[model samples]
Target chain A: MDLFEHQGKELFARYGLPVPSGEVALSPEEAVAAASRLGLPVVVKAQVHTGGRGKAGGVKLAADLDAVRGHASDILGLDISGHIVRRLWIEQASDIAEEYYASFTLDRSARKHLGMLSAEGGVEIETVAAENPDAISKVLVDPAEGLTEEAARAWVEGANLNPAATDQAVEILRKLYVAYTEGDADLVEINPLILTPEGRVHVLDAKVTLDANAVFRHEDYAQYDETQPRDEREEAAHAKGLQYVGLAGSVGVIANGAGLAMSTVDVVNQVGGKPANFLDIGGGANAQVMANALEVINNDPDVRAIFINIFGGITRGEEVANGIIGALEAVDIEAPIVLRLDGTNAAEGREILAPHLNEKLVMEPTMLDAARRAVAMAAA
Target chain B: MSIFVNKDTKVVYQGLTGSQGRYYGMLNRDYGTNVVAGTNPRKAGTDVEGVPVFANCTEAVAATGANASCIFIPAPGVFAAVMDAAEAGIEFVACITEGVPAHDEARFFNMLKRDHPGVRLLGPNCPGIITPGECNIGITAGHIAKPGGPVGIVSRSGTLTYQALYELQQKDIGVTTCVGIGGDPVPGTSFIDCLEAFEADPDTKAVMMIGEIGGSAEEEAAAFIKDNMSKPVSSYIAGVTAPPGKKMGHAGAIVSGGKGTAAAKMDALRDAGVRVGLNPTEAGELMAEIVAEL
Candidate 1:
């Protein structure tokens, strides 16, 4: 869902928004060649999925091609906020006459899309909103009408931009809004929308993050860098086609719904247990999904015990128990599993799970008893 | 006596031909919900659990005089289903489908305000609602919820609500209605919206609100409680002081800029005169204590 700076800039350029000419380089040699081709003064930016790379020393200007190579070498494979820099975006450096910031993101309060244009650019927008809120001009875009050219112009004018730059700013903002909405993006940011010494405006940086749920409509958007290694548990879970997010701690959780998975984590913590991961077999407690979940957790040495809490409504309890029994047979799971299955065929579910009623696999009648037992067992 | 669906509410099930629709529709009917009609674009004239199935929402409504709808359409077609439900004059719609795109929801909200100002949407990712002892339309455990007096439950979490209710059930606490607003980024109804409905219900006395980390919905609900409701309100915020996750919970549960955390929501609720539970286990006891104090 997060686009690298180079990818965001490509979309911006497609929309007729001015962006610094940039090339994505994978190796230090390529970065050096890109700097040489762009002619000496270029900016080498480590492509990561986070902001404030400038403060993190991930963004640096190269005075010469050799410097560019050195910076690229240093930045490549560097970790910024847990995201490893695998690529570098090399852009032709610009001489700024004036710097401004512009972004369009959804505003939950207004229940409409919001666009913020600020005279002060190249700084965190939150800082700007806090210190001098008046400096940032904001406009709420109607979902029906969208961002019109006239409305964008009004926003630009309100930002107190000079008349000459106002029209150009308006044009760029309108295009950016188009990129935001049409592109299924939740955030479209052009940080430091710079007016060059040549009297032309261009986007110095692009940060566009698309909504993941909308990615199904745009199949091409699903292409991502798969080379980066994920947590072993997460990768194992995903391999089985399960949506699993691993967390730190001892209690491994298996819940049916997304909301249930989150609440299970919370409840685990509340009962003095630390959760190892969040695994939602997604309303389907089939043997495969349960096996997949257990395989992911079984791989985790950190998980001391497992909690299988099922409030089966649409999903039958017998099916959930069958999945658990199937997972236990499929994997060499040593950790204790405390289960609480209620609703629709729960008695049958308990009967199915009765065979595994050892210290390692216990079934309780209530959620609290299960939670208490699971936490106590995990600690042991 | 309930906020949304009761015994009299005539309901239509969208996507009634699907396996999910057939199952839950039958279950709802069994729970005493008047499931009058259903909609499936391909399965017109087919009966699902004795309810008439039409080709679309308009025909279903026309045939059955259905005033409420429960949607089971997939994510891709959810927008059109919601639009159709609105156009068909369904006063209340419960959307159980998850993973609706934020843009589509934005458009849905806009269209609702423009064309169907009267319709109230329960959720796109929610578990729907249960008017205890009347009818159950959502994904919550119906057997756990008993029709009774006073307590009103609203939660952003489905499992936590069930667990909290399980705890409350131990103390013989029963609810008038239990609504799971879900943890989607763009929910159809919010915590504040539920609070307003609970406030208006004469049989509802104490209110229990369960929220997780993410979004300002809890804060908004707290502010609403501070200004309005004189009844006892007890709240428990999940994920208290949680470490920032690799990814946020659902699309809706992201705490950025030190906002919408469990601690922050608790503070807001405490400031608003609502009793804030230290943890969910204490939530029911807190509700009882708050009611006793009142």
Candidate 2:
């Protein structure tokens, strides 16, 4: 899960990384109060799970309390690439002598933790990579050994960071590595890591993405989960432990696996029908799971037709068919469901559904046929 | 012969007393795999059906001469289970447990690389490998696979792997083996691993690869196919319609920072002289055509 800048900074603080003292504000009044507590010249940053906040006018430098209130009120409702700001991080502004960038993320190809350090900061790292790839010092750390202090010191020097800030930067880099690994973070980035006039390296901005699968180990991550962006249908699906993504279309897609669900969505669009949502019931197609998935998709008024595609792997076709039949009996579905069942015992599954075959409940032999039928029904 | 396993491969279950373990382990044994032993510390000296249970993989391996291990342990216990199997000197380990922490996977993956270089770990969240009518390891349905040769399949998704298998079966085409690399950030195996194995296997003629949005594994596999293999490769990448930043069920199936897109993967495969299909069904048909030419 991607953490907002404020949340990332809070996590960085937990690791003893030096960050400008900040307070989270949910309203304009709260922003003023936070600014007053932090003294004048505070940075009011919009707390949204997206980037380019400064360019989008969601971040403002307030020299006074009135400015803080004005900036907070303006940014609270500002949309940065469709993510609306609902919170603000009012932090004491730091004087920057120089700016540098540092981050640790998984290099998927190398199967190692990758660390990137650069003198070029306060801008998109991608631009630096595109323009002057040599500016960034890349290091692949072995997960078994972790990022050692000696290696981190070399990485800091390789990036050509300010000599005066080298020691502090190295220390922060080690801490950031701790936050990345011990904290179960997929990415821990410090963009525009500032060196103050007094020669102290401080984290000016933090971008951390925690691994959602590891949330079971961290109890505090529940707060981050609460801030996730979800629509009504998505929220309901999440409640039911079903993986669902709301899309803008008329055909509701329910598939067994992630890849199949995505392929189902693509096939629906390939046949000239947009998918209303992408829902994967996962490995199990038991009665409760099927019913929950149907009810969630059935709640979407835009859904003109529902396509239930099951290619049984560990889940047998007979169980899938029974689950669908049981779900149909439990939930009053409005949209027509075009079903396609394949894999183990699929013939037995089809036989089980023979009596239930009707206009509102149709079964197709192949995925392509089922997709076509669903697309045509949606169009009609 | 298949890449990972064949009729001679002896298998052991790491969590044999558990429900999922007993279910799939027996199913695989019933399909003619030599499921010789199972490991459950508490249930040691007991038996599941006719299979003997041991205290750990070491005893299981020593007693039954089991070379491969199919893990059905839960997420938290998966790391230790893999380590135990590797330490026990198992040749191949296929872990079917999902939701394992990435750090644990990365740690053990590198540990195995550093220590037990001979052991081939398939997945910590995969459906495992199946050499049709020979050996079934994880949770893949044995009936969907046909028992001959010419086409070898590898995929990142479980059910889609089954779809590819069924599609080939419909065309009266059989597979030498099907490998699910698992849809996680750190998979034990890669598409290139299976592709290289298939390229080396005489029984396998053509290859079918299924990929989705995530990482550069597919792109790298495409590169490998271009330079190393003489076999025809048919490929399909899912999640063309998947919006950026949305995790599509799988933990690793997401498009982030304008990277790992289906379009990029397809283009790379197409540039490598591989037939890239628009969808799974079409991909299967492309593989069938390749098999027919063979």
Query: Candidate 1: global Cα-lDDT?
Result: 0.81
Error of 2 at A342 (Å): 1.8
Give per-residue CA lDDT, model 2, range B1-294, as digits (tens). 889899999999999899889988888888888999999899999999989999999999899899999999888888899999999999999999888888888999999999999999998778899999889998888888898888999999988898888888888899999999999889999999999999999999899999998788999999999999999999899998788877788888888888899989899999999998888889988988898788
Model 1, residue A364: distance off in Å is 2.6
Query: For model 1, how does the per-residue alpha-carbon lDDT over B39-143 read when each residue is reduced to its tens digit?
Result: 987889888757888998899888889999999888899999999999999999898887788888877877798889999887787777888778888666677
* lDDT over C-alpha atoms for residue A201 of model 2: 90
What would the per-residue lDDT of candidate 1 be over residues A1-380, giving only the tens digit for each residue? 67888888988888788887878899999998888788869999998888878888899899998899899998998888888899999989889888899998888766688999998999998899999999999999987678888888888988986555787898899889888887888899988898877778889888888887786787657564243246777777767867678888899988876556666777788788898887777653566677777878888999899998787756677887888888888788989899988765678889998877887888877656777888999999
C-alpha TM-scores of all predictions: 0.95, 0.97
- What's the true lDDT of residue B54 in model 2? 97
lDDT at B125 for candidate 2? 76
Weakest lDDT window of 10 consecutive positions for candidate 2 chain B: B240-249
